[model samples]
Target: MPVNPPQAPTLSGDLLTIHRLLQSPTQIQRRLQTIQDLRFVADKILTARYRSSGGAVLYDVSEPIFNTREVESVAPGAEYPKDVTPEGAAALAAVSKWGQATQLTDERIKRNARPGDELDRVLRKVVNTIIRKVDSITISAVASAVTATSPAVDNWDVSTANILRDIETAEAAIEDLDMGYNPDSILMSSTKYAFMASDDKIATLRRRETTDNPIYGGDIEMLGNLKVIVAPASRLPSNDVWVFDSTQLGGMADEAEVDPGYTVGEMAVQIQSERIARRDAWEVWGRRITVPVIQEPGAAVKITGTNP
Candidate 1:
């Protein structure tokens, strides 16, 4: 006997059937992946990931302050370790609800007449808008928590600007803190990153070292050992850059509860859909209830005045 593979169910008939198909586990998982793919920088910078277990309006976050104490050696049979209790403070982080909604009309669905095409289109737009909002919130929180320092002389955009020296100085500042954290990554505006990549000194070095590669080819993925993260200007200021240790920087927390009709998807994002009988449309909604918390401020340094 020959067995046939099952076919994907189509969205042809009633609103109930279409809604059920859209809310299927497979389709929901696909949508969740789209959200994660869009959040490149936010996921990188926010190293610590957490989820809220209860339905709480404010998320509680606690960060331990590392004590700078050395372990003392003692004679045999003596208590060498000092009696020191771990110290930390807990603070309430306000979790903001971010969401976007889109509708799939009967006319549009009928006109397309394809299985899940119209629904996918609506989900894509709604998911993108929600991700952008979440990214903006995360970036703004980091900017506010860290202090900015202006370059002493020329900015990176200038031909004479010593970009390497500036970056080294920033790294030194973090190392001097002796907080056991060294800057491992940098975040900057795309425009500034482009300028740095095409800078005269960088190009000369790359061209001289790797002659086979084109002069204008390849992105500035790393400055020495520091990883570079290029972000949109709308999220980060064009003239600003951040040098930080991702391990000690901070974390992000999201709501974990999944409502009756809602699905708790990847990165703790919740999504729901409703059928509007009056309008003969399906309204799709996606939301993220989360907050970004800065645990160690000294682990990050912001370099400003990168351009005119």
Candidate 2:
């Protein structure tokens, strides 16, 4: 006789148990949706911090100064009648206006500009939604586990590990979730060139050694950790060398003791080069990973016209 077909797994006390097992795939999908939501929230925060808001730009103002003067002069008087006349001179006062160069001053007005309208309320709503979604997914995953013996859901329980694993797997599955686009290398290169140009101008101003002192080099090299001694080259009683970075020159040619004529083009190149280096460092260290979206579950749900 043919054996009876194996009986299907029977559901026990609560309807939630049966519905949960049937909806496992849907639960995973929801978890991924939550992750995407979190990513969006993170992007908003980054944009708010990094993106510029068009704020007020102010111009410098000039003020004028004036001076006042008084003078007294005597005129010959005929009353004396002896070819010499004594007369009281009237006091005279004069006002004159002159233009003088003065330091320009500016006051900046504080701006209350915001990146987006109602940003505070929007941010609060986004934060609350993320918290609720994360909590709901976490709680549901734990509560539906087959091995759970109590009403309370324990997220760390081994029974819930599979759900957690699925979430991890889902996150790893996405391949296009970068938070920000990579910056252009050409822009970075230009910045580095500018930095180098500026550095060369700095090198010219440095004092040259008339006689050999430990601190003096024929030409300054832009070595990273080079130092300069403040003490005069001839007066050092001991051979002590106090060193300082070339940056201490503070962009003034007089301070560096070099002749004028450091071209602007050269300084521009150095500044650009330095900027490029900084950008490169960011490109290496600040890169963000993008999570790929697995469209299978969403696709299946779409095709079937069902929640799962």
Candidate 3:
């Protein structure tokens, strides 16, 4: 025999909403904790100091604007060279807009929160999220900078010899720019990292074996002189790789808000909080402010479809 199931209880509000219905002086809320990836890539190449919020245009000379001089059997003390060739100079500028993120907290809820640093931790994570978006925007700029005249992006091989060969070829392209360029960093996606790590050719040469330790993410450390960094999937695509000189690279220009703490860009603004009897809501607002423009594409070398 089945008795009528007691009617399920109905909540006056949804889990996402917090509206006070009782006159209780205190309320309690609990938050969950989780691990998040922190491998941000934009800072690696697009240095923060290079970033500007005043809407300044970046200007730089184009690489190899002048032809290399050819050496001919010169006559002893060739009658004082008539003229000297000057390296052509070109101006560069980057146009930037803004990227933003915001969060609203209920005052009543905050006051009654449990005795812990959870709330502060949550807010810190919000700030980090906004910065990561900047990284994504930077990578997009680099990818779009690709032009028809840009050096070829090759597909790498898995064998040990091929790996060294490809890396050399990629590095040489920038060094050959005759523009005094040297690749100082290499950025890749996790998928590519696994592909390289599993290569039987390099594995055979390994004198010691190591496994990934979650405390610190798996990293390649270095490949030749370039620092090997695994960029978040959001910033780097799985099939592509980029090698570039950090010295010549420019990054986001932003200022930290002293009173508060959010990074201020051209689009930065303060958001006010609202308070009413048992309810209070505060807001944070900002925007991503940087554009990646390759002033000298020659300094960067990208390879595509290595896993393929």
TM-score-sorted candidate list, best first: 1, 3, 2
The Cα RMSD in angstroms, rounded to one decimal, for candidate 2 relative to the true structure is 37.0
List runs of model 2 lying over 4 Å from the truth.
Answer: 1-117, 150-308
Off by over 4 Å in 3: 1-39, 51-54, 61-101, 107-118, 146-161, 209-218, 255-279, 286-288
Residues 1-308, model 3: lDDT tens digits: 65587443343333233333111112211211122343346667765354444555454535454545654566886764343565435544554544343444453243443312433344345546655666777777766664312233334443432554566677887788677777888777776766665656555555554554222355567766988777666665335777887766445444333233332222222112222434344343434444554565566777654654
**Index of the highest-lDDT prediction:** 1
Q: Write the per-residue lDDT of candidate 2 for residues 191-229, one digit (tens) a residue.
A: 222332234333354444543322343322222222111
- The top-ranked prediction according to TM-score is 1
Show the colliding residue pairs in model 1: none
Q: What is the lDDT of candidate 3?
A: 0.51
TM-score of 1: 0.81
**What is the lDDT for 303 in model 3?**
66
lDDT of 1 by residue, 1-308 (tens): 54466343455555455567665755666656654455546768878776655533333333434544666778899977765655555566767788888887776766655636677777777777877777788888888877745362477778788777778788888888776777899998877787777777766666465634345465667788899898888877345888988877887877766667777655556777777999988788888888887767777888766765
lDDT of each: 0.71, 0.22, 0.51
